[model samples]
Target chain A: MLNLNNLLLQVIRLLLTFVIIFLTLIIFGVSPFDVFESILYGSLGSYSKFIRTLIVWTPLCLSALALIYTFSAGMWNIGIEGQIIMGAVGATFVARSFLGDDLISPYLQILMAMFFGGFWGLICAILKIKGKVHEIFSGLGLDFVASGIVIYLIIGPWKRAGIASTSGTDIFHKASWVPTVGDSNFPIFLIILVLFLYIFSLIIFRYTSLGIRLKATGINTFATNRFNFSSEKYIVFSFLIAGAIAGIAGFSQSSGAYHKLVPSVSGGFGFLSILIVLICSRNIYFTFIVSFLFAALIVGGSQLQIKLGLDHSLIGIIQATFVLSWLVLQKIEIEKITYKQISKMFAK
Target chain B: MILLENTLVTVISLSTPLIIAVIGETISEKGGVINLSAEGTIMICALFGFIGAYETDFAVVGFLCAMVLGAGISFFISYCDINLRMDQIAVGFVLTILCINLSNFLGQDYVRINGPLITKFSIPFLSDIPFFGSVLFNHSLITYLSIVLIPLSWLFLNKTSYGLAIRASGENPSSASSRGINVKRMRLLSCVMGGSLLGLAGASFSLYTKYGWSEGHTTNYGWIVLAIVIFGGWNPFRAAVGAYSFGLLQVLAIKAQSVTLALSQILPLLPFPLMIFILIFIQYINRDEIKNVPKWIVAILGGNQPQSLGKKLPEEIK
Candidate 1:
C-alpha cells in the first residue's frame, strides 16, 4: 500500500511536468497536441526516420544512465559534457592513428574507443577528487578547453585535405565503425545500446556496494563518513563511471551515426543528458523513456521549424521551462513535507 | 601616452562588471549565502539591459530595469534557499542554467540592435592631474560609483549597525534571531541588493562598453566575479583591488598580444589558480581566528548558528 502511494505520487509529478511543458509550448504559439503528434509521427512516421531517431538516442540514453551514477553520489558532474567531448577526442585520435593497422581487429578497435572515452571521464573525476575543485565549474571550463582542442585539431592535424566547413577528420575505417545489427542496422544497434545501458544501470544502482555508498554520500556525507567510507573516493569513482559512460556516448555517436568525428558529432547530447536525468528524477529506467522522448522532440522540433517557420530553439526554451518548473515544484513538494508538515486539510 | 591611456581605459572598463559583482557577492557571502547564480543574474541583466536601452535609448532606464530584473531573479534563489531551507549551492546552480537559457531565448531578437554607449566623463580638476587624471578621473558615472562604492561598502560592513547585523546573521542565525534580528529577511535583502548591483554591472557591459547585445556576451564574467569575491576574502576593498588587478592583466593580454599570444590567452586562467590558493589561505586564517572571538561574536559571524542558541535565548527576544 505504501509502495502504491509512492508510485501514485511519482505519476502525479510526471503528469504535472507534462502539463507544465504543454502550457509553456502554448505560450510559444505551438500547440501541445501538434507537438505531441509531430513527435509521435516524426519518430515513428517513417521506418527509416524512426530508426534514425532511435540511433541518435542511443548514446544519449547511455550518457544519461551514466549521469545517474554520478548524481547518486551527490555530485553535480557538469563535467560530463567535457568528458563526452574528451571521449570523442579520444576515439577520434585512436581511429585516426591506428585505423589501418593490420593486427587490430574491428571489435578491438571499438573496445579501445570505449576505453579511451572512459579514460577521459576518469581524468575529470581525478581532478575533482584530487584538486578539490568543484566539478561544476571545472567541468564547464573543461568543456571550453575540450571544444577548443576539437577546433584546433580540425583546423590543424585532423583537417580533411580539402573541404569547406567539413571541419573534422576523415571517416573512420569501415572495420572501426560499429556494424549495423540487423537488416536495419541503425535501429538494431540503437535498441541494443539503450537496453544495455538501462539494464546495466538498473543492476548497478540496485545491487552494488559502490552504488549504495554513492547514494549515501549524495544524501549525507557525514553519515557516510561515520560508516568509515571515503565519500571523496566514491565521488571520484562515480565521476569516472559517469565520464566513461558519456565517453561511450561520444564513441557511439561517431561510430554509429556520424561515421566521422566532427564538432557537432555529439550535438549537445551531453547537455541533453542533464535534462533527461533531471526529468527522470535520476531513475535509470525512466531515463530510457525520457531520452527517447527527448530524442523525438529534437527530431520533431527541427521538422516543425522547417515545415512551419517556427524557431528551432523553441525546443530549448520549452525544455528549460520544464526543468525550471520542475525545480520550483520539487521545492514546493519538499516544503509541504518535513518542518511542521503543513496540512492540506487546512483552509486554502 | 596613448597606449597607457588605452590600457587604463580597457582595464577599468573590463573591471567594472567583475568589481560590481564581486563587491555585491562579498556582501551575499558574508551573509552566509554562496550564490552560484551570479552568472545567471548577470546574463539575464545583460540581455534585459540591452532590450531596455535599445527600446528606450536611455542608459539609466536600461540599467534600472536590469537591476529590477536581476533582483527578481536573485529573490527566487534566496526565497528557495534561505526561507525554504533548501540547499543553497544546488538551488543557485539550477537557477544559473535556467537564467542563462531564459536570457538567451529573449536575447535572440535584441542581439543585433545597438544602444547608445555611455561616454566618458571627466571630473574638472581631477581630470587635469598628471598620470592619474585620464586613467581614473575620466570615466562614466558608473565607473566613478564603483570607485566610491568599494570604500563605502567597506565602511558599511566594518562600521555600520546594519553591517553588524549582516555579519551577526552570517555567524549564527539563531543568536541573531534571539537578538531580535530577522535572519531570513536580512539574507533575502542582501541577495536582492547584490543581484541589483550585478545587474547594473551587466547593463554597463552592453550600454557602456559593447553598446550592443549578443548571446553569451557576459562571457563568464559572472564566474570570474565569483572567483574574485573569494580571492578578496569577502572584503569589498580587497575585492576592488582584486578586480582591478585582474582587469589590468586582461588589458595587458590584449595590449601585449603581439608579444605573446599564448600568454594572452592563458592570462584569463590566472584567477582560477589564485582563487583556490586564496580559499585555502582564508580557511587556514579563519580556523586560527575562530577560537579567539567571543561566543556571541562568533555566533553573529560564524556560518550557521549553533543549536544551543535557540533554546538558550529569552523567549520574548526570539
Candidate 2:
C-alpha cells in the first residue's frame, strides 16, 4: 500500500513537471507539440541515440546510487561534485603519467581515481565529525576549493604545450582510454560492472545488517548507541562508499565520454543526481528508471538547442521544477496531519 | 599614497554588495531561517535587474524589480519551510539550482548588453578632504545605502521590539508562541525583509560594482556571504567587517598577480579554504570537550548560534 501511494505521488509530480515545462515552452516561443515530439524522437529515435542516452545514464545512475548511501546515513554530501572532480583529477594524473610510459595499465588509473575521490569524501566527513562544521557549508567550501585546484592544474601546471585554454589537458594516449565498442561511445564492460554494483547495493540495502544499522543511525542516532552501533562510523563509511561510486562516475566521464579533462567534465551531473535521488525517494529500482528518463531529458534538451534554438539549460529548469513540485506535494501531505499526531510520532 | 587610496576605494566598492548580502542573510538566520538560495538569488536578480533596467532605462525600476523578485522567492521558501514543515536547507538548495539555471536560460539575450549604471554621488564637504575624500566620499548611491545599512541593521536587530520577537522565534519557537509572539509570522516577515536586502545586493552588483550581467556572474559570493554571517557571529557590525576584509583579500589577490605568475590564479581561491578553516577553528575553540581552553577564549571565540535555529515549529502554532 505504501509503495502504491509512493507511485501515485511520483506520477502526480511527473505530471505537474510536464505542465510547468509546457508553460516554459510557451514562454520560449516554441510549440509544445513539436517540442514533445522532438524530445521523444531525439532521445530514443535511433539505436545510436538510445546508446547515447545510456551513456549519459551511466554516470547519473552511479551518482544517484552514491547519494542513496549518504542520504541514508543522514549526510548531505553536497561535495559530491568536488569528489567527482577529485576522481577526474586522480584519473588525469595517472593518464598524464602514462603519456611518458605507454605500458601503464588502465585499471590502476581507475583504482587511483576511486582512492582520490574517497579521500576527498573523507575530508568532508572528517570536517563534519571532527571540526563540528555543518556538511552543507564544509562540502560547498570544499567544492570551490576542488574546482580551484582543477583550474590551477589545467591553466597553471598542466597547460597543454604552454597554451592554457578551457579545452583542458592534452588528451590521454589511446591505450589509457577506456575501451568502447566499435564506433559507439558506450563502454560495455564498465556498464556491466556498474550494473553488477547496483545489484550488489540492492542486496546490501535489503539483506545486510550494516544497511539496517545505517538506516537506524539516520532515523535516530541515539538508538544506534543503545544497540552498540557507532553512528559516526556508519556515517563515515557511507560517505566513503558514496565518494568511491561518484569517483568511478567521474572516471567514466573522463575516460569514456570526453576522453579529456575539461573544466565542466562533471557537467553538473553531481547536482543532477541529487535531484534524481530525491525523486526516487531512495529506492534503487526507482533510481534506475528515473535516471534513464533524466538522461533522456538531457539528450533531448540538447536536441532542442539544435532544432528550436532553445538553451540546453532548459533541462535544469525542468529537473528543478520536478523536484520543487515534489517538495510542495510532500509538504501538503505533511500538513494534513494533526499536531497531536505529530507529537505522538515524535515521541515514538 | 595614490595607489593605496585607489586600492581602498576599490575594496569599499567591491565590498558593498557582499555587506548588503551578509546583513540580509544575518537577518533571516536570526529569525531562524537559512536562505541557502542566496547564490542563485543573487545571480537571478542580477540578470533580471539588468533586463529591467535595459528595457525601461530606469535603474530604480530595475532595483525595485529585483527586490520584489527576491521577496517572492523568499516567500516561497518561507511557505515551504513554515507551512509544510520541510527542511529549509533542502528547499533552499533546490531553489538555488533552479533560480540559477532559469536565470541563465532567460538572460542569454541580455548578456554583455550595455545598460545604465548607478550614478556615483560624492558628499559635498567630504569630497574635498584629500585621501579620505577619494576613498570614502566617492561611490555609487547603492554603496552609500549599503554603508548606512550596517548601523541601521545593527540598531534594528538589537534595539527594536520586532527584533526581540525574531530572536525569540529562532531561539525557542514553542515558548515564543506561548507568549503570543506568532513565531511563524515573524519568521515570514524577517525572511521577506532579508530577501529584499539580498535583492538590493544583487542590483548593486549589476548596477554599481560589476556593471553588467553574465553567466555565472556573482557565482560563489553567496557562499562567502554565508560564511561571513557565521564568522560575524550573526552580528551586523562584525559581518560588515568580514565583508570588507574579504573584499580587501580579493583586491590583494588581483594585485598579487603581477608579483607571481603561477600562484596568482591560485591566490584568489585562498578565501574559500580560509573561510572553511575559520569555521572549523571557531567550532574547535567552542566545543565543550576542549576543557583546556580558557574561559575568556571561549567567550571571545565561541559563537552563540540560536538554540533552535533549524527546528520546525509545532503545527499548533500555525
User: Taking the candidates in order, what DockQ does each have?
Assistant: 0.22, 0.67
lDDT against the true structure, per candidate, is 0.72, 0.84
> Which regions in candidate 1 have their CA more than 4 angstroms from the true location?
A1-6, A28-30, A39-44, A100-133, A137-141, A144-178, A181-191, A253-268, A333-348, B171-180, B245-318
> Candidate 2 residues A1-348, lDDT tens each?
369867776676667667867887788777888876777788999888888887788889998999999999888888999888888888888888835236454676678889988988898889888886788878887887888888888887788886776678888788778767777666785788689989999988999998988888888888899998789999899889888888888888887677778877787899889888877778999999999989998888888888888887777887887788777776565324546688889999
Q: In model 2, how large is the Cα lDDT of residue B121?
A: 91
Per-residue lDDT over B35-89 for candidate 2, one digit per residue giving the tens place of the 0 to 100 score: 9899989889888888888899999998998999999898989988898788887
lDDT tens digits, residues A1-348, model 1?
Answer: 379866766667667878888877777667888766766676778878777787778878888888898889877776676677777776676667755333353445446656765676666666666554556545656665666566656656687767524456787776666667556666454467668767877777799886788899998989988999889888877877777778777777776777777866667788778867876778777787878877877777767655665655666666666766766666566324633444544534
User: How do all models score by TM-score?
Assistant: 0.83, 0.93
* Docking category of candidate 2: medium
Residue A33 miss distance in model 2 (angstroms): 2.6
Best model per DockQ = 2
Fnat, 2 decimals, each candidate: 0.15, 0.77
In model 2, pairs of residues that clash are: none
